[model samples]
Structures are given as structure tokens and as C-alpha cells.
Target chain A: MIPVCKEIRKEILKISNASGHGHIPTCFSIVEIMYAVYSNMKHYPKNPLWEERDVFLLSKGHAALGHYCTLAKLGYFDIKRVYSFGSFMSDFGCHADRFKVPGIEASTGSLGHGIGLAVGMALAFKLKKTDRRVFVVIGDGESNEGTIWEAVMVATNVGLDNLTIIYDNNMSHGRGLQIRNPAERFRAFSCEVVEVDGHDIDALGPEIAKRGNKVRVVVANTVKGYGCKTFVQDQYAWHRRSPNDSELEMLLRELDEETI
Target chain B: MDLSLHDERIVMILGDVSVYLFKDFNDKYPNRLFNMGICENTLISVVAGLSSQGLVPFVHTIAPFVTERSFEQIKLDMCYNKFGGNIVSCGASFDYAWDGATHHCYTDLAILRLLPGIEVIQPGSYKELDVLLRSQYDNGNTTYFRLSDHPHEIDLPVQFGKGAVIKDIGAEITVMTAGPLLGNVLEACRDLPVNLIYFHTIKPIDRELVARYSRTKILVIHDAFGLYEAICEVPNLRVSYHGLSDEFCGWYGAVHDIRRKLGLDPKSLKEFIKNTIEKTGS
Candidate 1:
């Protein structure tokens, strides 16, 4: 693991341990994808609302801790403030609120929502005749919502080449609504498709950068918990469970020992 | 949209509802108008995305599908995210009454007004829609413009959040209505011993004007659900609703059939108002 993304995973662990909230396993699944998107997308951490900047939305909002950590590491805000995640009156909540956070484009908690916002934004760029693009990260589980496919269909039909959707294929949907071949489905919907390993930033970054002829989709195959063995092996148990002191230490040790 | 000429940010996204109506729109502003298919949810979501980029978008379609089916999209993407746009819905309430109950839309204004950071307008006239749409479209909040095919010819003052009092005679009874139903409502209360009030805006429900008639027994008469519920928001007012029973409007022919059946026609309204005046001994 790269040091920054590892550091993000550690930060997510520490915050969720301290805050007693968050879908930590889900957050871990998208660490590298989140890092890859931020590192590759054209955005200013200091000037978040800069008119000419490209927009990124974390559509599967349960992984917001990962998104907040990604933005903080990218210098959007101080990492120290994120320890208050899910606390009362805290800007950083379980789901990202665009008004509260600097880089968050839209407040999303409900599945199938943020992708639609991303579609609208991509269409806006097309209408405005701007080179600015939109990036959105949706979860495998969130695909069960019909609105996700609805958005993808619109993005494809409108030929929004500027919109790049990153599907965090963490198989969280395997327990429920299964999308067996997401890439084929996306291709059937007429999107430019690329399959990538979610944890490998080297593989993810280029896909994030590649703008295609139609709506581009990067279906990133990822583990539900990439860094820690305990969460990965027993994902459903730790899906929404925060760690105690001992578990946090064990997870930290497991993360430090991770070689991938 | 005349705003389309000067303000290049105004993009109209339709849900395959009124595509032919905007043939001129497509011709005049080629790239600005998009018939964004039959997906209502996607249209609102896309409009939010467009608004996030400082672009003003108008997502128009049939009232129920766009407003009811895509209610979550509007609540989460547009209102909650504070992405400003214009949501112009045609076929208000029973405007598509011939298309049956699924095509009917009366809960739009009522349900939409419940969402925070939204402006709900049921414009009764073309002048009202034109004036109010121009006035409020760029204000940077989710503003819903419910348009009707059966617009009244009444030329009332058009404002974004204020109410228009047509008749404020100091009678003990007051009749409040909104949107195109004002034509029937006005004729119903024309020679009655009561005051009549009309509104284009619903959310910031003109609390002061509504409160002004608090001393009177307010009769909320309309063709739909929202105006009655909105009037009930004002405190200490003896308000009673005279529209929309708690069952589906099962039968359908035209908007007129539904209106007459629901007792929203001028004759029924007139008789109801006269009876209210008699019952209360006003």
C-alpha cells in the first residue's frame, strides 16, 4: 500500500474508533480509489468552489469517512477535525454534506442519488461548452437502486463523454442484489468500460484520467475491507461496527502488516 | 423562456412530456434544450448537477412523475444539497384527468412544500407563470412552478412569495384558493358576503396575509390538496377544507368532470360558500 492511502485507512480506523460510528469496512474498500480520484481529478483543495474546476461526488455516501480522509490528505482541511465524525454538531457526518465539507459536491446518504447529480453536472458541462468534467464513486451495493441505472442510461444517451463513473465493486451487493457482470451491463447501456483493481492506485489513476467517447465507467473490483484481515474475512459482522481499543490496535497492526 | 436569450445558463430538460411544445425552443436555442427522455428521476438529478456548476436548469415533465416519482431526487439532490434549479411541471392535478388517476397530480404542491429550502408556486395564469418564473428562477433554490392548461384569464399582481387578495371585504367568511382553480373560486365567491384570497406561492405561505383573515372562518376551496393544507399552516384560523376526498379520483374524463364531481365548479362552490355563510350565520 502507498503510505498516504495507508495513512487514510489508519485515520478512518482511528476516527471510527473514537467517534463510535461509520461503515468502516465500506470506507476501507475505496481508500485507493478515493486517493486515485483525488490525485488525478482537476480540483483545488484551497479553492473548492473555483468556477473552472471539475467536480467529484461520492455517490455511495456510507464510505464518507474514506472521502473525508481523502480530501484532508489532499489538503482540503485539517485531518485533526475529522475525529469528530458522526458527532453532534460536527461538520463531518456519516454521510457527506456538501455544505459542511469543502470538496463534497452534493449531500448524499440515500442510494442512487449522487450518481444522478453527477449525470446532471456532466450534462451541464456539455451544455455550457466547458472542458470541465464530473467524477462519481458509486458502490456495488448501491447499484440495486433503479435510479443508478436510470442515471447511467441518461449519461449514455446524452453522450456525456466527460462523466467518468467509478464503480467500487466491493461485492457488498453479493449478500443481496448481485450485479454479476457490471461492466457488461454498463457496456450494454453504451458506456466506455474499464475493469481495474480498486486497491491498486497505479491501475486506478490512469482509468480515472481516461476520458472516453461516451460515458466512461471504471468498474473497480475491490475487497469489502482491503487492509484489515478481520474486517475482510468477516465483512458483514463489521460492516457498520466501530472498533474498540483492542480491536483498533489489532486492526492497526493488521493494516501495518498488509503488503498489498 | 426569454431568459434563455440573455442568460445562457438556462437549460431546459424535459422528460418526453412536452417535446413538441419546445420545437421552437430546440430551434431557437439548439444546445440549451434537451428532451432528457422518460426518466423523471434522472432529469431532476441531472438538473441538480447542472445547478451545482452555477448553471440554472429547468427540469420539466408531467406533474406526478416528475414531482412524485422523483420526489426523493428533488429532496436529496436539489433541496438538501442546495443546488438551485427550476422545476416546471405541466398537467397540474387533474389537467390530465382524461389519462386516469395515475396521470393525476394533486399532492405535488402539498408534498413539495414540505421539503426545506424549496419555493412552491402554482401559477393560475400565463402572466403569473411568466412573471414569477422570470423573477424566481435565478434565485438559487429549488423552486417548483406547477403550470396548468386551464389557466384563468385573471390578471393579478405576480410576486414570488406574497399573496394576492382579490376581495378583502370585512366579512366573517374568507375563501382561499390557488392556481387555475381561482377562476371557479372567484366566480363562486363573486357576489357572496365573504373575502377572497389567491396565491401563486405556497411554501413561505404568506403567513401575514393568511393571518390577516384569522378572525374569519377561512374556507379553503380548490381543485386540489395543497391550498387547503397550506392555509391550515396559519394559526388560530377556523379553516375547513372543501376539496379532494380521502379516496382516489377513480373516474376520469376531462379536468372539468373531476372538478365538477369534486364540487369545485363555480356553481357548487357558490352554493357551498352560501351554505357556509348561512351555517355560520355570517
Candidate 2:
């Protein structure tokens, strides 16, 4: 799982370097969370739209490079296809588009939309009496949207225990204001909040697996740029900036040396 | 009711409005109905999600909130993603006139028409609303149904993508419109020697009918903005438009009073049509 995360990060960097456009740090921060969820979740890559498959939505749609790489690694498509991330011929855009991509559950780029989409899917699953669960990965910056809280209230009120939310608490917001105490806020919404180290798969795997009668929120505390040394502990500038030539070489070298 | 009864996958979602109107609907299918409070953005995105799951979701709210407040969601989630859902909006134009500009929607048709593959329908009466709703649901496309309080007793059968000739006496001038403004246009042209055409579906604009009446002068009297430009695609048609102008109505009054102030009332529309006919010498 750790090696897969490293590989996904490498692929994301390659796509960003080729396209000269992507949310690199944002995608890097969520690689482990994506790896943990994809490794443990029930999904058939060949049959992407299988009815009984558990749903995964990247609410923070800017981190689409990470999602594309993860889906490619899971054998949903060829990894080579993702290299055309920003090109007109490519199905993958900077933001995830569901119609073009097979494994993407929903088209998301605008903030505060994915939570409601997940809630609706979760409600449908409950109505159909299916045991399938829905996992949505949302950014902490995206949490500032009021619609997210509206979905949270409804999910808790409806007792959608089959729905799980993984908040990428990278402590970096777009407008330079960090969301203070997201776990307490989730608790206020009556969600069973579970705090975990976002980069550590051992801590994230078990927390994501836990399900009960209430909506569960796993707050994964992580750094803005997880693996790369240039922007690892940096703030908002690295959110979407592409790496220069030397920076790209340095990132690839760092990934090679890091013992997962 | 017939559509929902036949297809159990059809669900209705509300945005803290239209509960009284949907009481009977909720009583019949309680599980299929959901009230998502006042969150219009969530209402649209949730409907998109439900549509993705192969369920036909019909979302209802006031016009401005559903179409304007959540415009991005409707564009990206529903239209861009090509998800099929029905957005049924009430309080169109100035129906909720006393509630001020916040509740009224005058540009929804123009905004939604720009979205690819979305069918925009504005029913002039209860009969048209029922027929258009059922037709769009059966087609299972991304459609927007504009509902209003005006009820016109017309004999024309409501078709999905076609226009109805309300009073076609082959006159020199043709007046086209949709929604509640159809009633005003009909009353305004009752004594005039002109032809009247009402459109239940706005987006497609019934191009054939527009081309048929293109040799003569045409006047479009509508409550919403941009209908004239949308329907005037025919080159030969000498078109003059009378609808809500670019100015915002920030005051409060009855819908008719507001329409009169905006030069859309029956009296103003009649005078405008007479002036147009006299100027064209048709």
C-alpha cells in the first residue's frame, strides 16, 4: 500500500510536469487517504458501474490527478492515458469530469457540492436496502462552504450510517484562513468524528472501516505537500502551481530516496 | 401523479417550499418525497446525484433560488455531467411580486438555454404544465419546467417541442409568448387583427413555426428576458420584442402592476403591438 502511494504521487508529478497545470500539493496530501480507501473498498475496476460496488467521490475535485492515478493503478484504465491530463484529447481534466472518466462517480470541481451528492447516493442505497457504503473525500478548505454543513445536518438527521466522510485536514485553506477544530464542528453536527494521521495507513485503514448507526467523519490531519521536500510544509502557493525543471528533478529524487 | 404512479423511481425533492402544493403527493409516496430545507444548491446537486444512481428526481423550488442561486450546480453537476433530472420552478417572473426581487426570476430561461442538451419548458396553464411535465419525464432528459399561477383555458394539445397557434387567422402580424404572459398577450390581441401563437416549450423555440410566420412582422410578448433573441433565429422575420427590460424592479406591488410598469401589461402590450403594425404598414 505504501509503495502504491509513492507510485501514485510519482504519476501525479509526471502529469503535472507534462501538462504544466494541476493542484500538485492538494493531490499529494490526499494520496495516502485515497490509497487507504481504494485498497480496502469493494470495487470492480472492469465493471466500474456495478450496482453493488461501494461509491467513492472526491469532493475536493482539484485533486483529480491523484484520483486519476489511483483509478489507473486499480486497473480501471491504462496509466498511460492519464498523461494527457490537460490536453483537449484527454478525458481527465484539472477537475474531475464523470462523463469522460469511467471510474469517477460524480463530476466535481465547484466546492460544497460533493457532500450533497454523496448524501443523495447514501439515501438511495438505504432506500434500496443495499449494504453498499459511500466514501467522500472533502478538503478542509472546501468545508467553508455552507452547503457542506447543510448536507452534514441532513445526513445525521436521516441516520445514514452507511455514509462516511474523510476530511483532508491539511490545515491549508485557499483564502489563507485555516478551519479551526473541524472535529468539534463535525461533533456539533452529531457525526461520530474519528481523528487519524492522514499519511499513516495503519491509523487510517481501521478508522475508515468502522461503521455504525450515525454518520462517521474521519478527520485525517496531514501536511499540505506530504512527500515532496520543496513544498512539503508550505502553504497555499503550492496548491496548484506546477514544478519547474530543477524542482521536478528534486521531487523525483526525494520520492526515490524515501523509504515507505 | 400518473407519471409517478407508473414509474416508482420518480422522486420529488423540495427546498422548504411547495410543501402545501405537494401534500397529496407526499401522502401517496412518502418515501419518494424529501424536503431539503432552504438549501437550493444542495437540492440541485443532490438531485444530480440521485439521477446518477438511475433514479428520476424532480426538484422543486422558487424560480430565483433554484435557477439563479444554484446556477453553477445546475450547469456543472446536471448539464455538464449529462445527468438527467427535472427542475420544476414556481414564482417565475413576478408571480411573487410582493416578495420583492429576491423571489422573482426573469432570466432563468436565457441562462438555462445556454446549457447544452437541457430542455427548457414554460407551461402557460395547468393543462400545459401537466402534459409538458409527463412528456419530459417520459423522455428522461435534463429538463426545466417553469410553473406559474396563471391558468389559460386553451383547446390546443400540449406538445413537448412544438408551439400552439392560439388564434391564427393568418393576420399580417404574429405574437408569440409562453407562461403567464400568454394570458395577457391573448387578451391584448383579442380585438386586434393579428395572429397569436403560444409556446409551452421555450428552449427549442419551435423553429418551424417561427419560419412559417417569418414572412410577416412578429412581436414576442413574454415575461422573461431573452425570448425575442432566442426565437428570432429566422432571417426574414422582422422581429420586435416586448418583455422584461434590462432594468431591475426593486419595488413591491401586484404582478400586474409590475408588468404594467415594465410595459408587459395587457394594455401596454396592446398599444405596443398596434404601434408596431402601424410602423410596418402591414
Candidate 3:
């Protein structure tokens, strides 16, 4: 793992431990993907509303803790402020709200919603005749929703070349509606499809940079918990569990590959 | 259509409804109008995205499909996110009466008004549709326009959230109704000694007007469920709804057919109003 991505995972563990609220396994899966997208997206942390900034939406909003940590790492806000996650009156909730946080282009929590918003935004940029693009991350598990395909079809039909969808194929769908062949399905929808090892920053950067002739989808094959074997081995158990003090220490050590 | 001409940022996404009505607008602005299949949920989400990017979006479809099926998209994507857009729906109540009970839509206004920041407008005529669309389209709040195929020819004053008083008779019974049914309601109340109130805007519902006439027993007559629920929001009133039974309107033919069957037609409504006046001892 890249130092920053590792640090983000560590921060996720710490924040979830402190706050008693975390979609820990889900957040762990997307750390590298989020980092790559943010690093590649044209956003000014200081001026998140910069007229020319490209937009990013987390469609699988359960992974909000990962999104906040990534934004903080990217200088959107102090990383310390995220400790207040899920608290009353704190801007940061388990699900990110766009109005409450900088760099959150659209507030999303429901499955299959963010992709449609991203499509509309991409279509908007096309209507405006601007170079601004929209990138949204959707979980493979969330693909169970029929609206997901509806949005993808709409995006492809409208020729949203400026839109890039990152499908976190973390196999959280292993138990339920598995998107066994996401790349083929996207290609069938007329999207430019690319498969990549989600945990590798180098592999993701290039794919995230490419805008296709139609809607582009990066099928990031990821484990639900990438850095720590404890989480990776029993992901469903840890999917939404915030680590206790002892568990946090062990997870932190495991995140460092000390006892893996 | 004028909205797109006046504002370059306006975009329309349709769920395969009202395509021909917007023919000229699409011709003028090809890139701005998208007939995005019959995906009501996706259309709404797309509209929210357009709104988020400072582009005004209008998603049009049938009433039940857009407002009922995609309720969450409206609640979260549009209202909760504060990404404003215009949701223009056709087939008000039983406008698709020939299409049967599956196509009837009366819950749209009632359910939509429950969302915090949504502006629900049931345009009774072409004038209300034009005026309200011009005023509320770019206000950066999700606005729902419920349009009927059969618009009543009454061109009364229209506003975004204010209700209009047609007759301020000091009669004990106040006949309150909204949208296209106002014409039938008006006709029904003409020979009767009762006050009449009409509303084009349902949400942020004309509270002041409803409150002022709170002393009088308000008879909410409409082809839908929302106008009564909205007026009742003013609190503690002898208000009752005379629309939309607890079952699907199983019988259907046309808007007028359904209206006549439901006693919303002029003659039936007049009889009902007369009975109400007589019952109230006015």
C-alpha cells in the first residue's frame, strides 16, 4: 500500500474506534481507489466550489468514513475534525452530506442513487459545453439495485464520455447479488470498461485518468478489507463494526503488517 | 420551453412521457432535452445531478411513476441534498382513466408535500402552469408540477405558495379545492351559499388563508389527496377530505368519467355541496 493510502486506512480504524461508528470493512476496501480518484480529480481543497473543478460522488455511501479521511488527507479539512463523526451537531455523519462537508459534491447514502446524480452532472457538463467531468464510485454490492443499470444505460445512451464510474468489486455481494462479471455487463451497456487491482495506486491512477468515448467504468477488484488480513478473512463480521480499544491496537498493528 | 430559451442551463429529462409536447423546445435545444427511456428513478437522480452542477433540470413522467416509484430519489437526491430541479408530471389523478386503476395518481401531491423542501404545484390551468414554472423553476428548490391533460379554462391569479379566494361568502361551509378540479368545484359552488378557496401551490400551503377561514368548516374537494392534507397542516380545524377513497379507483374511462363516478363532476359536486350546506344548517 502507498504510505498515504495506508495512513488513510489507519485513520479509518482510529476514527471508527473513537467514534463507535464505522463501516470499517467497506471503508477499508476503497481507501486506495478514493486516494487515486482524489489525487487525479481537479479539486482545490481551498476552493472546493471552484467553477472548473471536476466532481466526485461516493455512490456507496456506507463507505463515507473512507471518503472523509481521503478528503482530509487531500487538505479539504483538518483530519482531526473527523473524530466527531456520527455525533449530533457534527458536520460529519456516517453518511456524508454534501452541504455539511467540503469536497462532497453530492450527498448520497442510498444504494444506486449517486451514479444517477453523477450521470446527470456529466450530462449537465455536456449541455454546458464545459470540460468539467463527473466521477462516481459505486459498490458491486449496490449493483443489486435495478436503478444502477438504469443510470448506466442513461449515461451510456447520452454518450457521457466525461463521466467515469469506479465499481468497487469488493465482493460484498459474495453473499447476495453478486456482480460476477461487472466488466462484461458494463461493456454490454456500451461503457468503456477497464479492470484493475483496486489496492494498487499505480494501477488505478492511469485508469482513473482515461475518459472514454462513452461512460467509462473502472472495475476495481478489491477485497472488502485490503490492508488487514483479520478484516479480509472475515469481512462480513467486520463490515460495519467499529473496533474496540484492544481491537484497534491489534488492527493498527495488522494495518502495519506487524502480525499479519 | 421558454425556460430553456431564457436560461441556457435548463435541461429536460423525460421518462418517455410528454415527448411530443416538448417537440419545439427539443428542436431549439437538442442537447438540452433527453427522453431517457422509462426510468423514473434514474431521471430524478439525473435531474438532481444537473441541479447540483448549477444547471436547472426538469424531469417529466406520469404522476405515479415519477412521484411514487422514485419517492426516495426525490427525498434524498433532490430534497435532502438540496439539489434543486423541476419535476413536471402529467396524468393528474385519473387523467389516464382509460388506462385503468394502475394508472390513476392521487397520492402524488399528498406524499410529495411531506418532503421538507419540495414545492408541490398542481396547475389547474395553462396559466398557472406557465406562471408557476417561470417563478419557481430556478429558485434552487425541488418543485413538483402536477399537470392534467384536461386543464380547466379558468385563468385566475396564480402564485407559487399562495392560495386564491374565489368566493369569500360568510357561509358556514368553505369549499376548498385545488388544481384542475377547481372548475368543477367552482361550478358546483356557484348556486350555493358557501365560501370557495382555490390553490395552485400546495406545499408551503397557503397557511394564512387556511387559518383565516379556520372558523368555517372547510370542505376540501379535489381529485387528489394532497390539498386536504396541506390545508389540515394549519392545525385544529373542522376539515375533512372528500377525495380519493381508501381503494384504487378500479373503474376508469377518462378524467371526466372518473370525476363523475367520484361525484367530482359539477352536478354531483353541487348535490354533495347542497347536502353539506343543509347538514351544516347554513
Give stretches of model 1 more than 4 Å off.
none
Consecutive 10-residue window with the lowest summed lDDT within model 2 chain B: B149-158
Query: In model 1, what is the error at residue A195, expressed in angstroms?
Result: 0.8
DockQ comparison, 2 vs 3, better candidate: 3
CA error at residue A63 for candidate 1, angstroms: 0.5
The lDDT of model 2 is 0.86
In model 2, the runs with Cα more than 4 Å from the true position are none
DockQ of 3: 0.91
Candidate 3 Cα outliers beyond 4 Å, as residue runs: A258-260
Q: Please identify which of the two predictions, 2 or 3, would achieve the higher TM-score against the true structure.
A: 3
DockQ of 1: 0.87
**How close to the true structure is residue B65 of candidate 3, measured as C-alpha lDDT?**
94
DockQ of each: 0.87, 0.74, 0.91
DockQ rank order: 3, 1, 2
Most DockQ-accurate candidate: 3
lDDT of 3 by residue, B95-186 (tens): 89999978888899999999998999999899999998999989999999998888889878877789999999798989899988888989
* Model 3, span A24-114: residue lDDT tens: 8899889989999888989899998999999999999989999999999999999999999999999999999888999988888989999
Quote the positional error of residue A157 for candidate 2 in Å: 2.4
The order by descending lDDT is: 1, 3, 2
State the displacement of the C-alpha of residue A18, model 1, in Å, after optimal TM-score superposition: 0.6
